[model samples]
Target: MVKVLQQATEVDYGFRPSYRKVWMAKQKAIAQIYGDWEESYAELPRWMLRVQLTMAGTVTVLKTSPIKLGDQVDESTMYFHRLFWTFSPSIEAFRHCKPLVSIDGTHSYGKYGGTLLLAIAQDGNSNILPIAFALVEGENAESWSFFLSNLQSHVTPQVGILVISDRHNGIKAAHEAPENGWLPPRAFRAFCIRHVAANFSLSFKGKDARRMLVNAAYAKTEAEFYYWFDIMRTENPAMCDLANRMEYDKWTQHQNSGRQFGHMTTNISECVNSVLKGTRNLLVTSLVKSTYERLAELFVVRRQMAEAQMGIGAGSLRSTRQTGTEHPASVAYNGSHRRP
Candidate 1:
């Protein structure tokens, strides 16, 4: 912003603005456009309430801390702490998607710095379906617990679901805790293969070793996994020990019971983060509104595609019956179908 202001002024008035002057102007502009940081925080409850009212079945959970004056808590002076929200269509759509969820957190570059945590699911056709979102202070045990607990209760309550994420201690703590329902028999936890391979690179350098580790993680059978595992062990015996320490089912495909649905990474969440990257610099209210709009757009497009496919299938079947053709009506998911 400072550089942009400097260059703009230099071109318009032939005078480069001072860094401090540009910074002050930027703050004023933000205040005028999106309101100040504190005011944005105050607008959160009203914004969420409006969202719920405007969008039926939209779920929003906002956590606030009450300000205390010596001994009494002031009801009028509550501070925003955390928020979790999911749209009605997203909730309904997930039942038809693959039974897997990938979660990840991206740093917010807004007026008040924080973290944006996301939980996204994948459809049968390998499309990313964002399910839940949260704004928290940072990634910690308490924040993760709050996010996961709400996610499990509101968004993904189905049993035997798979969750893929990085092996952050906070996430581990939250999922492994019995009350969160993310433990065994309810939901299985797996590590993101990309993150696991990145960690492996920290211990062993070179692309060859990293590729070998990834091959092991992606192997779908015991024999294939050991084939790459033995190669890594031969190259560096300590690498085998390090990989063993991280556990097998958490990273390896062979041990995951096919629950991963071929999604070995948190790429869905990463994709969502990239889509919202520009909004990260906006005020909290603005950021949330942008996400709602984007997700609504996604849902509308997907719905139209599905409706078109159904129409194509119905037409194909009708044509086959009219012609009395022995050839069956085939429907391929390549966004278009052929006549029988």
Candidate 2:
């Protein structure tokens, strides 16, 4: 709160309400942006304040330990090496705003071989919303399963959520595994098309063959997709045989998950990754705190853009995507664009 006072203008929160029911989210985010300021900017114009905040602060303060509150009163002193969840007011920042969720794990460079599993969603507005995240070890079926199970435990479930992710052996099994008396069945899992193609291409020869087969998998319509599948099956019986045996169709779920380009291979998740390239690697305390803060900055930019557009940019709501519809995928803060 002290930091916020230094960074933001004194916008009277009385009478004039510019937001919807989610006022708290907006307020918290505004505080975070200004809270990093070195001195008060109360006299600055609002737009300039936002711009100043975008390039505000130094790295030392960015990585400083969070101010601990009150007196410590804990019995157990277990080392918190892995972080399981993350919270932000703009958590719902996504374009194809849907209850749709995606979960993935990135290996941590820290000791003990750790992995972070992040569960994200699309919010009411079209921002790549981050629901919850977790830190785990060795991203495998057991770890992923526990992560998903924990996510389910935390959030409120929407009617039909189609979760898009890779066909990692662990994740696939975790989705299919008998809930161990827990977890949900409707959490339809989808395999990354690129991963599937790359893995399948490794088994065959010639560039044409790989391209042909890959196209078949991404062919827009189910008819076209299946048509390509059959052609590939004939061209490379071994590949088809491998796919059938592994039941890959059981995981090719996104095509029907009601989102723009769900049928095609869209690496939006990786696009998000490119945004945090170095930041994720610099994470500490088992949590990518720095990454989280940077992401907040990215969201502020998106918020500004969203304000400018004034018009709905396709996947701009928790709405579904279908044939002929186009949506702007979420933008990320590629660290390379550092404002010197």
Candidate 3:
């Protein structure tokens, strides 16, 4: 901000403003443009209503605390507590993507501090698709329960889905709770390998120990996983004990039966978090607006790419029909030249 002010003001007036002045001016400009923080909270309902009205199937859940006067509730008074929203396209897109969800939270830098929780999925082409978002007071058991419960109830209701996240107690508490639908036979929970390795490093130390943990996590076979496991045991017996306590099935690829879709970390969710980094400091409504606009633009671009791919596929099929001795359809129907 100071640099921008220097470029805009100093170049014209040959004078540089102090940091305080620039900051105050920026705050005033933000207020003038996006309104104050309290007003942004007031606008959340209207903005969310417009989103749902225009985009059918969009889900929004807003939790607010009602203000009370003596024994009666003031109908006009309410304070924003939490919000969970997901777009229709994102919800539909998850159906075709891998049956895995990675969730993570990042701190919001707005004047009214909060945390943004994200749930992301990976498409067949390995593209990251953000499926749901929630703004909460912080990353706690209650907040995680609020986000994950809504995510499962509305966004990812498919049973036996794999959920990957860090080893936060809040996430564990929420995921392990029987009513949250994140336990076994409903949805499986896995720890992010990166976070697991980081915690291991804190105890074991050294890059070699971390590398061994990562190798074990990425092993495609039980034998290969044990090979790395033995190496960690040889390096430090304590490492094996820690791994055992954390449960090998949650972090090891071999135990998940490919349900993890080769994802070992919450990097996809963190990538989406970084994508929204610029809007973190904006007013609440503006931050939500930015996510909506950015995701809409992303959907438009991906749609164009998909259409282009379809066009290319059709062109190749027509060309093959014109130049080939036997039709591709006959090869598939007759199963003569098709390889099993």
Candidate 4:
């Protein structure tokens, strides 16, 4: 029965059922298969490690590390401090996406508490592309530094690359620190507008103020930004002063040094977090597996959708040309065609 359910779930979701659900189904099958047997939750960590190890062996360019001491090589020194993983496919896919990447940390509710740090990018079609994932002890300066250091090495931020995230002190310090800061000289950092809006709402009370703040952030030009900003300041000088204290380049689109590609918030990362909510309570390994499987399915589905769209677009272009509605040269072919 458990096997049947697993098959059904994989067919529908491209992955297996959650461990708790599988365990419950196994409980009913135990009497018939193994005669009153049960599995302990404590064994889940080891089981998950085994699965990850197997995956690492099979998947080329797959990286995985279990928690252990940096100095010693003994059982006493071994501990689960963090877990990190990324695959070649994700890294390669990021190269074709926008130069912006959003980083965020979500708390994991597994028996052994930890934080899941993710680095996500946006593709040409504005789809969320998962770049890297790490399970850390917590969201502190040290943990964030470690995660960013690894990410810096992995992704290697280029000139004009944009990093969008919330105003977490750990993240702020990690990127701004002189010695090991992740921000390259050419790259820029921006704050999520939604987070900025929420903070503003807490300090200043009024729907109009909130609307003006958002409008200011989304302004496409300096004149437009100032236009909305003046309204906020005129309505409430104190609130405007507070908002001004935050860096202009970090919140406003017009002031950003790097190309944001029209993204002003870390909502892309947040969307990925929402999808993993159900797996957050699972063991470390299971959570990782769920992320990996779900991402694989997402990539497959989105790629097919994009190809289908391209096919339709090509067909429509051909039909238009045959009907003499527009000449092929007038359709703008890579700067080759020009208007009369």
Best by TM-score: 1
| Candidate 3 structure, TM-score to reference | 0.88
lDDT string for model 3 (1-340, tens) is 4468767888899988887687677767778888997888989999999999999999999999888889999868788999999999999999999889999999986666899999999998888999999999999999999999999999999988999999999998999888888888889988999999999899986899999999999999989999999998988888889899977779999998788988999999989988998788788899989889988998999999878777766666676668875465544322243433
What overall lDDT, based on C-alpha atoms, would model 4 receive against the true structure?
A: 0.74
lDDT digits (tens) for residues 1-340 of candidate 2: 2234333433544334333323444444544654422222222233333433554421111111233337754434323333344343433233235656666666654323467566666555445656566556577777777676655544524434566677778877777766622234445555666777677767877776667666765555677767767877777777667666644443343255354234334355555555555444332431345555666786788778766564343333323245433333432222111223
Q: Per model, how many backbone clashes are there? A: 0, 15, 0, 0
TM-score for each predicted model, relative to the true structure: 0.89, 0.58, 0.88, 0.72
Residue 293, model 3: lDDT of 92
Quote the positional error of residue 121 for candidate 4 in Å.
0.9
Q: Could you tell me the lDDT of residue 150 within candidate 2?
A: 56
- Candidate 1 versus truth, CA RMSD in Å, comes to 3.1
| Model 3, total clashes | 0
Candidate 1 vs candidate 3, TM-score winner: 1
By summed lDDT, which 10 consecutive residues of candidate 4 come out lowest?
A: 57-66
What tens-digit string does per-residue lDDT give for candidate 1 at 208-262?
8889999999999999999999999899999999998987988999999999977
| Candidates ranked by lDDT | 3, 1, 4, 2
Q: Higher TM-score: candidate 1 or 4?
A: 1
Residue 269 of model 2 has an lDDT of 58
lDDT of 1 at 97: 88
Cα misplacement distance, residue 77 of candidate 1 (Å): 1.4
